[model samples]
Target chain A: MSKNQTVEQRYLPEIQRKEIDELKTTVKGASQKIIADNIARMKKADSHRPDTMKYFDDIANLFGRRQQEIEAEKQKGKKIIGYLCLFAPTELISAADAIPVRVNSGWYDTSKLGDRVVPVEVCPVIRSTIGAKMIELSPFLEQSDALISVLTCDGMTKLSEILSDQKTIWGMNVPRVKDSTQSLRFWSAEIKHMKTQIETFTGNKITRNSLKEAITTSHRATKAFRRLQELRKGNPVIMGQDAMLVNQAYSWDDKKRWTEKTEALCNELEKRVQQKDWVCSPDTPRVMLTGTPMFWPDSWKLPALVEEGNPKGIIVADEQCSGERILNDPIGVDEWSMDDMLNAISERYLMASTCPCFTSKDGNEDRINWLLNKVKEWNIQGVIYYVLRGCMLYAMEYNRVKKALDKINVPVYYLDTEYTREDVGQLKTRVEAFMELLNARIDF
Target chain B: MSTAKEFWRWHEYRHTMPNIAPVSDDIITAGVDVGSVGSKAAVMVNGQAYSWGITRTGSNSPESAKKALDLALKDTALSTRDLRYIVGTGYGRVNVPMANKAITEIACHARGANYIWGSSVRTVLDVGGQDIKAIKIDATGRVVSFLMNDKCAAGTGRGMEVFADLLQVPIEEIGAMSLKVEAEPEPVSCTCVAFAKTEAIGLLRKGWSKEKVLAAYTRAMAVRMANLINRVGLEPALVITGGQSKNVGIVSRIETLLGVKCLPTPNWRDGGLDPMVAGAFGAALLAKALYEKTQQI
Candidate 1:
């Protein structure tokens, strides 16, 4: 906060240091301080519940070690495909003998570079993605033989068009509406076309056996995450951010390794749950994060919120994506045929479409039902509808979420947010006040 | 909880205008709003406005809350104990010491604007230091819908301060001085405060007059705020409140842009209520309602 220190150094809020800087917007003093603080807090938090830390400590490598892993795979004669959206189906890319590295935009200086090419008004996620490519800051973007963009929202659609000029951008047209009976067949056809594109681009034949193995590996990771979600139901053994990191690990690292580490974490979490050892104060208020995709290492809001805020007894759970959306559903393929497996994948993804991207009459009802069930299941006290500043899809649905939560007599706090640390003070104040409101609402 | 206010006051800015001399102890309620840029406190006696104070918030929001109350209580025969209930609102609401309840500034601003501007006022635009809020309200002064620009200061008072410092014009003179420009210049077109500051310097370096630069910045503020206002679908009988209402440059440009005249905001100098204390005033009103509800129980 001194005169000489940069604005980021002065403004960056209290974040633990040991964890990866997910947003990767590095501040000098706060970054170092957070590193030290994160180590101490994670230790202190994990001390009482030894079962939780066992897997978390080991799996920490999944964050910063992405580029190195991609490089190692490239040296192993494997092609890498950097994908933007979850709908891209990494399993298919891997089936074609290409390593699917999930690429996200969060590097700080990339935005300045991006401003020259794209209007500054576009979403920061897209800005940073294009910026990363322009500056060659993203290892995944650099390493990938091709990039896949899932037409999830307006931003991704525009991003795909712009990025196609530089890279082999495959724009996968996933239908926006989810309710039509033919949409499954529609999406299944799209995925089948995507497989052909990958096979053609990588010049690798995607055999039926390879596809099955990839689905099984993906199922294991999500199944482990499902177990982790079950652990979140009672006594909250795993802090929400740590659980989110578990979900994020699926996209960044080797799938088999991610599943193994997550399963190990889940095993510890199971023990802690049985022992009734809770890291958070029993008074902790459970809050479900319902909003847009909060990309890893590029999105630090979750970690920042949970580090100090969770300690204040506010536990964040059930993120819209990169948290629950990635982990909630499984790809079905009991018969193991190519067509059958593709159908199952489409069906599971349809079931996992909790995002408002597939807006329909049932959108609010379906989402509200899921939220209501989760609130009751996890004993949630409130819901935090966190949105990226320009992410209108999630921001647009706040009223429906609030209306539903209101009926259930639960409070919902709508947070329009961004990646910068400048407004950390303001966010903290609002969150603390919300905590006070939730506490006061509790019936004694 | 902490008595750190004793020494910190020397470094902080504090002010109170048109102080009230408390005569009755009947149903006295207080509200403190510790905002990012400034803090305000209002004391209401017998469901009526009494006195209020404004101060620049330091790190200790609790002290800012207490100091705000202290200044409001100054020149009046009143103390903290005299207030029956204390309600805290705004960004640092939870940090306020001795607050019976905490509420959001959006709700408070709507209710306060309704009370000041009249029950017929359906829209409330609150431009605070670091953020801007546009609220739609019903006849009961209950919030129908609200849009708040999160974590950006480009169109708010904080942005105004940046332009003020760059042009060597006092914050108070930004509005009037901007209007004096012979011909209006195109507004700076960046939403980022930091980016817009650079854009502003570029204009000045091009030999644009200080008035011209101020004119551009003011139009930009109005343009930025107009988008936020259009979000909730502006209703007639619109009113502006909070610290930014004092800036005529932004307000008049906004009026021109909206093509609808703004409902006159409160001005203490004109013997009207201070519009800046809307959040705190509304908090006090809510405290009275809560106090009454408890009394019935």
Candidate 2:
């Protein structure tokens, strides 16, 4: 061992560390290119995109202007708390006077670096997130003072353990059964524990007023998100990818600014609806995407393929954790007391979530019910169930979702994929075939 | 046929009917299917199959599409301008230069099977060059649901070709020769084609007969196909299409595994169409319907 080496430093050699640093430089350029290409495609997708979408494009640019803003925040001695899953209560982070950033990495190249630490069979999201930390690639992940790791699924739990060695890690155990009253009490206690952890990490006392104000910030964003969802229902003036970008920016951009920008986008869409300017024809097959969450550049491929051809399909809505469901359900509080507010936050993040991670008494009936209601509300003609490879929860739940959709005569196409670009040709053929079946129904 | 040293080659050919019927007021449409390994062009006169040509796909898809169409219309009076509409199908469908619209091969195969075997055919198992698709359809030939083999290339025409090259047997003759084995051997037992190829090489080194090796390979292919067919929830009467359908070794094995006889695809010598051209044929049929719809408007 070297003279200054510790136990942790010995496991990872200096030579391997130097190699990873070199790889990090190349991955940064490739990741920026992926973001730029996707943003270019989004802008040129349809002529009806609102001008306010530029705000989302800028924030989602990865190492662009938002990265600079984050660096500036770091310079001002503000702590950045990175959260892995949606179960990490951002309200507490903001209340503790720290910036909350969701650090789920979607870049495919970064996953290769993560392969050194984790096995190849793990899901790409976990690998990419770990790899991003290993190389210090993502600005959001690099700037974080601590990471809030929610043990939502099996892959995520292991991911937290691997990441804890690099950063000060705080853990949250999500109860599996959402319908039980006992689970809520357990989760409320966990949330209280988390508040104290964040307070100690950031060295800021989270008062009742601070929590109240943070909840208000999220409520404004949720109200704008609901408005955007309502605008997508009757007529699709905004493309699905654009709407997803606005939501994805919630994880990066300042929440209050995201709220104002989304509201402005909704106002622009309202005017388009009045003028009868639609992105696609009235009869194009409206499809809903469900299953595992897809973030940023990785999510753009499917939406682009869906909206590609003449008389193309439009992604009218999605039930993914990364999409419309990101913040659509606002937390309701009867009183502003600390205990009542924590109880409300716990219930909202845990109980109301239809994530596949939670298995109630019945098998996936909650998620199925949510999907069916959204399908009817959006006039969805087809459903695309996307499962990222190695994500066992979503992959295993495909049949239950399919069986439920089958009962209503709404066809579901099961798409199993990874974060790689090699499968684009295969995915295109399957998606086009599904579109053909939907079109045949319309014509015949 | 192979010489003492050189490998036997799969020949490429094209044919059209010697006689043509007098021109009528029927609308003519065509389809071009540019696949990963093969390209086919089919011409339909008044929603009836007129002629088709199949050729090996080259490095350039648009050129291959043109060559296939040229062969289909070799001695015919109909030209590209004569057809009211042209639709493209298969993996390289969008690369067809003259295609008016691109339809997916899944839809095309179901519709083509319906036309080839009549409306009674409700399930189709199309084993293509690089993919295997099991499609379930309604009585009217519209696709109800379908499943295709992912990323892996086992149980496809390409997989069969690998065996043919390894055994030094002609691709067509491998099927009949494989059926002559005393009894079916256990399948290659590898779900991946690369691993199966290695296993086949290992079996050959152990002095297994060529016919027995062929039997084992085809059986493995059949099992892989059957798994996909079961997943798609097969309905009868079933029909098989694509180049692999001509392989009796794979076909009989699949029939036995599924316990259902696939309806016959009439031989070309018997004045019937080639099974490989099914995707193009279906696209042609859909092109006619699309043309009629436009005319109505």
Candidate 3:
């Protein structure tokens, strides 16, 4: 088998392996329904698809197995509530003993629903968001006890108000505090307010001790994760593409298992880092990520192209929402002042949770400049901006950013991804060309 | 009556006393714009701002328009008979019977914005009493694209008026009140103007200070106005013309958001030059060119 094929085989889960084996035989004779049914069954059995009905059944099974533990907790009489944010500090919320859910809208048919509220000329993100609201397609919308809406974008603000009126809405006004001292104070107050809101919503008071405990646990996990990523940077022990997938799944899967597996992975990664056993492909070109990640499962191909071409060179320095914003934030509960701790957390969340839809041009420019600075620091050869198709805000602003980066002499490539699976090959070709261009520049 | 005639006779005597120059016909083309909030008339006699008239659009827009036109004509001592073409522009432009042609307020405002300021302006943001427009312009004062926020009164002069009434202060004093505020008040978060008024009332009942409330209102207005500016990318020398230009509070907040200073016209008062009239002036200039071309054809 080819190197890429071997890597793919090595990474495939047991269920995916079974499906591949079945697909080889099914392609010769099975009807479309049979094939689909088989795929669906496998997906149902998989614990990774947390939102699937089968995943819920698995949770029920776990509940059944842990009935004594659950009953004892129930007897303790703690109120259970779900909180949603663009990127909520899961560690903080978990510390508060409240379930924190990341609210992301699905990519369904939005043309009809979007037309009802948003103007036709507005960007597609706004349209899709409006469409999601009109059709109520958000997985967490119905289940969420309270929603925390950050002022990340104009569209998000509008959607938050609309959703909040339907349910309990907590407005998180994370300010753009630039000074480190001021930022810490601001983040601390925000966290305190969040704690209060959590208490109000769940009617379960979060004591100082619990908050600190939660913060410590989350801080440890984040530090470990960061260390693992840093290790990858030194030696191509882990493919950058695999790192991205693991990060994406980090928030979506069962936290206990994810943490355990990640710890194991980190241990393995530490050994590799010590041995200096990093993958190296001469053809691979290092590229930094910019812009929003389109909701395609195989959009991972953009980073995969770099790995498949050259194993160790590609590193993602920035991401629109997923990469840094979701992964980098840690609760600042160790500080003496709870307010200061909250402020620090809030500021990081504010700076990190920047969506393209926000009205601050300077903020957006600053983010781009920071990313470029990191690229230079890491010796990255090129930058790739993955723009979502129909996202108007980014589409409109892309040229402006390009002009700004051009002055700095950084080569930038833009790829538009439709969150559909069919565009994988087209995405692969574009990414390949982008990687090649970066490599050519390095030679010169 | 005797004193009035004596004064006129003295003015005539003084005019005759000097080595006076001969009178010229000086055929001038003029444009009149009667808008929802104000009326303005401009006379370009021999390609110059010979004279202009402006007044608040009151109960009778057409009469105010006629008064503005008459004032411009009187300043030059020229009658309607001396004009080759008369054009009207604005929301109330259709009501001006003396106008040979009428144009929309948008085209007129863009022309006016470009005329008063040199045309390096890629975008024009005008906040009138009833409407607000973000216009993109070419080097020659022609509109490339434009966006307006007229569906609601939250970002317009009317919203300010409502807040002024709620505060029991004159609408003109809002700018000064906002300046005195050391701390910004809680933000008015409601989208609807009417709902915001209720929210403001609740705040008052809660004993929040008035200046703080006004400051909050200013911030909210700034946020709404900045949305338009953000839609059109920021270019330097941004000229903010209209009644809202007078509001120091709104202007300061806008500058803070855009990180650019707003340039107001020298004659920001007197409704400045009506954009509708400016557009009509442009149209007349175009017509003159067309007429000259047709004569050649």
Candidate 4:
């Protein structure tokens, strides 16, 4: 424990402690393994899952205790602010003397009760989030003093409306138009409002020096994350979805500490690459994944992508929303007054972020170009465009993305998925077919 | 186990039986489809289906595949070694240890359906035990685009199997019985097979006749399949393949919904080929292609 952290704050909230003791629900399903298969051609890790990382089971099983841990952080005089989208920069919240914890629910069964309060057709993540918080099933509601939501889509905007009655929420106006001067200015204004909210809630003046320090801390994490990303290009040294976990942990863990751990992991990964230690054979089909934010137990795509059912192993590259999204852009904070700092943060998130919701024709075309470049650069022969069930914006952009990838004769598989095991068989068939095409083209 | 109690178990619908014989010619290339519902093996020689066998898939996919292949080669007096090339497909395609190559059932279905229905068939809708696929094919029977339902079982063959068992109707009789109803009750409105089962029981308890209940479930399956088919954009030449293609109840309802009958023949050839064999037939064709390519090299 950190010197400033107290024992009381770290203890599990009474209700969760009792539930965890009785059920062990969070601890028991602690391991999710993605078999790299017994194919003779690959050198990748035999399995990638909770056991792949150090303290993986401990971290994965730590879900039920999260609220108390964050609460404990709060007792150490840190303000806990929950965020929903990548569009809302955690750096800004950190600059304001608050810890930004992304509030995504991982318990698939627990999210079922969430649907009583939401429409059945709403996105599973949204329904689950609403259910978890409304039912007091999630530690997020218990730990968070405030919420920062980027109004990226209807589900999130409405989620903010529903959640605002429970706690303070500052909705960031995520503009649809990317790279526009007006949109950038508008987003910057929203960040300014967010600054005021943080000030009022925390009762601490965020000085220029403190904000600049936060930016520096954030940049360190980005550098480490970027390093991991570089290690993942083409033939990945890191097997399976372990790289995804490193990125996912960034969403919840303290960025500086997560950076150190990731950096350390990168060093280990660097050695593996040098030693020619790989999880999959060089012949494994390389796939570029996009669509849907997969976090924690919200994991379906990663396992399906690289699992044994596809015969020869498949290597998954870090994708738009989950992998490179958080680490790719850093706020350039030279002389960090509130205005300059907020503008930098806004620029990093709204302008630089390549989310499809920020769709201007030129912006979308650039995203396609970026995807095409990623395909060739990463040796990705196939693309899996996975859309979360009821995710409209991402699903809508499929045709545009597909056309560009198609131009290069790259095989693309579009999957509309939910967090359920029932359809895994179907998904496997589609992916296997895609793999067949990709593998056949390998010789060509 | 009786199909009723086993309705909840997807593999219980597993069937492994074959009404098969041999062509007694050079048809030796093999295609195996080890699916969640069933396993099939087709042996092709001289560009014609020689002998094929169907069997219920067991827990071990490779074993089921081998069993089907053994049965397929029985009349021909051959073994896996005798076949020039073998292509495995369906959900268990990867599990076929003896296959030279594993193809996606989507591609296999497209290739197989093209041969059965003919080249003009542009759209292929295949509802397997646990999946529903709408595949758009080019003139050459290559998959141009495809869409699949990856949620709960509603429009799939699994749902029909459950309804068949729930009503205590033999799986074969349910289709005919569904049409025998005097009037169609409102089709069960749920998109989940489990929920539709509950709805089936509720309707049965409400004194709805067995035929009527079957009719309701069948109609619901049609509506669901139509929605999926519409999403992929149905072309003029549409055909239904896979296990569910045999269900006259769902097929008739789908025809009514589209107001056009599904192809009576596989294609313009006016030759009748069993729909279930389409995936295996396609695999055989691909195996043949690969074998010829290898020989040329």
Give the higher-TM-score candidate: 1 or 2: 2
Which of the CAPRI classes, incorrect, acceptable, medium or high, describes model 4?
A: acceptable
Global CA lDDT of candidate 2, please? Answer: 0.86
Deviating ranges (above 4 Å) for candidate 3: A1-92, A106-142, A176-191, A253-257, A272-282, A294-316, A329-334, A351-366, A389-408, A418-429, B1-297
Distance from true location, Cα of A106 in model 3, Å: 5.2
Mark the regions of model 1 whose C-alpha exceeds 4 Å error after superposition.
A1-66, A96-98, A161-168, A177-182, A196-205, A281-283, A306-316, A359-376, A379-381, A395-411, A429-437, B1-52, B55-127, B134-147, B151-297
| First chain TM-score, candidate 2 | 0.96
The TM-score values for the models, in the order shown, are 0.69, 0.97, 0.45, 0.77
Q: Write candidate 4's Cα lDDT for A117-227 as tens digits.
A: 666778888876765664455565558888888888898888888777566788888888786788888888887777777888888877787788888998898898778
Best by DockQ: 2
| Candidates sorted on lDDT, descending | 2, 1, 4, 3
Best by TM-score: 2
For model 1, residues A1-444, the per-residue Cα lDDT tens digits are 578543332212223434224334443233335434554555665556445454544444333455676788799888889888878788888788789877776544466556666677667787777766664556678788888888888888888877775677888878767777777778888888888888888888888999998898888887887877887777767666667766876776778887777778777767767787777766777778788777655365555564455124445467566668776778867799998888887877665677778775644357777888889988998777888767878888888888888898887777766656677766765565455456545521
Q: Which numbered prediction scores highest in lDDT against the true structure?
A: 2
Instruction: Write the residue-wise lDDT of candidate 1 on B1-297 in tens digits.
Output: 864222112113233335545566489898898888789998888667887888888788899888888987886767888898888888888788789987778767777887777789998899998888887787767766666776668788877777777666777777899999888888888857799889989988999888888898788889988988996689988888988888788889989999998987665655567788888888888788878878885
Candidate 3 TM-score versus the reference: 0.45
Candidate 2 structure quality by residue, lDDT tens digits, B142-187: 9999998887787788877777787888887888988988988998
For model 4, the DockQ equals 0.41
Full-model lDDT, candidate 3: 0.57
Worst 10 residues of 2 chain A by lDDT: A6-15
Superposition error at A427 for model 1 (Å): 3.3
